[model samples]
Target: MSVTQEEDDPFPVDVSLFTDTFCQETVYRLVGQELKIRQVFGANLGVAAPVWDAALFLCHYLGEQSVELSGKRVIELGAGTGVVGILAARLGAVVTLTDLPSVLPQLADNVSANIPSVGWPTAHPTILPLAWGQDHQNFPSEWDLVLCADIIYLPETYPLLLQSLTHLCKSGALVYLSSKMRKEHKTHDFFEEFLQSRFHVELVNCDHGQNIHIYKASLRKDL
Candidate 1:
């Protein structure tokens, strides 16, 4: 998607460039279904404002025939537009879509748009505010799967994210984290250092064009 900049526009030219993709809703096809995600752009929203490519990659991986979703309990961390979690719910997983308190409104709107009010056989996704380490304890650790997409960009949050992941995986929940391999973000270090230390991490898929890598993780028995 492309946006044209106006000479009289008050916002910065660079910001205007993002208008088309971030200022409006987008429709995505996943798991043979369509999801309309509402995206909001603002200075405060940052990366959580729009649906990222990593999230789409994870959705594709989950839709694979080999993967099973029926009856699984899934929780998605940093679910910006609720696409991944919404797809999981449609595929028969009981899902929870979580993010910072500020992001919940848009996330909830996306969930409502994609998931019907009635006739949904599986459990609908629960939209909630989850601030990684701070809120992990509030949620039960019995989830069958934990989903994260493009949430590892901020290095300062690494420890906090690890804390949350450890807590969530305590009951043997499998984690699928899809991240863009951005060099400046040091995304690789998180997996090689913090995550591998506590959980068994494996690279399950990669989308070269998008520079996204999907990793499957489980808590280590010793930990």
Candidate 2:
């Protein structure tokens, strides 16, 4: 079930077929605030790119009834369409959105359209290009929290993803991941084995009654 690392196509099939030339507007409720998000449909799917419901759940868990988002640095890996990462910024965390270079342009566009509206508190929440298991030295070595949603659909990237998370997480950083529980069990088994040794993982159901799990692990002291 592992996916071989294939070169991601820069064009993403076709732009006209997947997205309108104009930006699409959407709303996400987080921490009791209805934050606005602007997104463009993928050039290939023509559907609104999927947002990570798990990240939303985490936001609710962390901010429940709190209005202030202060003093947190966040990084989101595999930020397709960049929704969760942007929401983190809107919530007041200094956020960085990362994904493959091929996917960055669209992600940048989405961030550009929404960041102004959110009035991001500081010169923060930047977007950058990064591939899993690759060099990330240009970015901060540790983040208070790291996020990923539905990035584990392909098993081949699992090891790379895990390694990248280990490298970027701070000493006591919390890692939140969400997936739709696909039929493929290998991906699940692999992560369970790989992460159990390091993280304290838990499954939390979402408002939609879907099982979204949260994985929290501190960096190994010896490492």
Candidate 3:
């Protein structure tokens, strides 16, 4: 689980793993980048909270100099607060930020407030309501990247997430999945299905103490 940092991704490996107190609009200073986002608090806390795994994924993906997200079409599933998607939007990626129907309003609000400053105009950040299992024919399948973090908690969601991941991406699409690996074997169960699927997957990084990992996956070959 040790990460090799050879000046490519200089961000510290000991990133935050847990966050409970929610902020209305917090300006996060990731290793070398800054993102201003709002997390659902007070009565609205029923929907979303700041996720550390999402933060960690951003720190590495954005920090790495070789990784180019500019102009890439990215979609994030279960994008609770839409922080990661907002950051991706800021990085010049046209992102579709999606979640359950109930969470769309708050997620859209955050995306709107952040768009003026950092978003691609040609392919602006879009908000969509996408339940994992439900298929949408209009869903963009030519996405250059599929993004998610800490979504594999529910055992029932294994098939849904896998199906969405496969359906949304065309051949050779890149997927970045992050999660705080829980002991209920949720992540392991997803990996079991992921292994059997046609996508090629690999562990990009792991934080053993936090029981978190970031996995990079791509289609193995043209289908």
Task: Give lDDT: candidate 1, residue 170.
Answer: 87
lDDT by candidate, in order shown: 0.83, 0.64, 0.69
Provide the TM-score for each candidate, comma-separated.
Answer: 0.88, 0.75, 0.79
Ranking by lDDT: 1, 3, 2
lDDT against true structure, model 2:
0.64
Error of 1 at 155 (Å): 0.8
Per-residue lDDT of 100-145 in model 3, one digit per residue for the tens?
6657877877777766553355477888888776754558688888
Worst 10 contiguous positions by lDDT, candidate 2? 1-10
Candidate 1 residue-wise lDDT, 1-223, digit = tens? 4345556422212343244434688888888877888888854355778788899888888878357888899999988878888888888889988987767888878777886545455886899898866889999999999999998887767888999999988899999999999889799999999899999999999989888999999999985
25: Cα error in model 2, Å: 2.9
Off by over 4 Å in 1: 1-22
**Candidate 3 accuracy as TM-score:** 0.79
Name the runs in model 3 displaced over 4 angstroms: 1-23, 42-47, 116-122
lDDT of 2 at 36: 61
